[model samples]
Target: MRVTLPASGTEVDVKSLSRTNAKRLGEINSKIAVKLAAAKADGVTEEERKSAAEELKALLDEKEAMIAALYPDLDFEALPNRDVLALIAMTVDYSLNVPEAEIKNWIRSGNGEQTQAA
Candidate 1:
């Protein structure tokens, strides 16, 4: 995907473009460094890998929200949801070492529908 910068005809890949998302993404990327190290070790459990991916995906989606919020004039809706989600999932997989139960707890806490049940 491509978007023209404000007041400039030059076009750039949507990933390269930056607003608030840029900084948050940098943090995510930094976090991934730790994940990658863990993944390289031979004994990583399948659950760990899965949790890392999911957290990465969530962060990337968050980055999209940040970009959209910061650049309302830019037509971010043009970006494909699958692409964005996939990137986020991959990021979560590659970058974080969250325990699966912790993530599940977080998910449960945020589930509005389930909140009523409790």
Candidate 2:
């Protein structure tokens, strides 16, 4: 599939994640959740918090590497922040096969459900 960056309009060719890659992504997300939980746990020491932060950083680096591999031609460092985010969103949408309308609703409602006025 092809996605155009929101800011730069650079067209990127993206492939759906293979089973192995999707599993790896799930593992990465689980690790991040663990690190976040550790950081937020009651009676967490300062040293423990710092360690969790460092671990989270490393996990994020790995995730970024995976994303780079997925979008090989996309130059993330040179892209504007909005473009970078758009690419990530595109990746999620493509990888999960999420409907475009659902994504738009998520963006509109900020929590994936529409709000009714009082």
Candidate 3:
């Protein structure tokens, strides 16, 4: 799979995400889930929730990010600002061979009907 960074104009050759990276992604998502639950329980303001979300996203850029590992030349710090969205999308689509437009439609419609088997 390949991902292009819009800000830096760099193309990243991603050979399907590693199991370790998948695990890390899952862990981060779990943390977000917990935070969201807590925010709901505490009746946190939307602005506060948004701040927490921004901080969680910053975690993706901290240290040796999984996306950085996919690019041979760039480290986490070298990644362009606002380009992390591309990396996240590429990671989710890795090995699936799903077209970008289809993915976008799925996201828009929130319909998760599975493809029929042969």
Relative to the true structure, how large is the alpha-carbon lDDT of every model? 0.50, 0.72, 0.59
Best by TM-score: 2
**Candidate 3, 1-118: lDDT as tens digits:** 3445667766665456667766777677687777767667677888888887786666655423666666667654566656566556655666356665454343332233434435
For model 2, how does the per-residue alpha-carbon lDDT over 16-116 read when each residue is reduced to its tens digit?
Answer: 67778778888989999989988999999999999999999998887777777777677778889787766666676678988654554543423234445
Give per-residue CA lDDT, model 1, range 4-115, as digits (tens).
3332332433333343444566786677777777766788899988887777678656666754554355455665554444334323432354443443343332322322
Error of 3 at 7 (Å): 2.0
Top lDDT prediction, candidate number? 2
Error of 2 at 84 (Å): 2.2
Which scores greater on lDDT, model 1 or model 3?
3
What TM-score would you give candidate 2 relative to the actual structure? 0.75
Model 2 RMSD, rounded to 1 decimal: 5.3
Question: In model 3, where do residues sit more than 4 Å from their true spots?
Answer: 43-64, 95-118
Q: What is the full ranking by lDDT, best candidate first? A: 2, 3, 1
Winner on TM-score (1 vs 3): 3
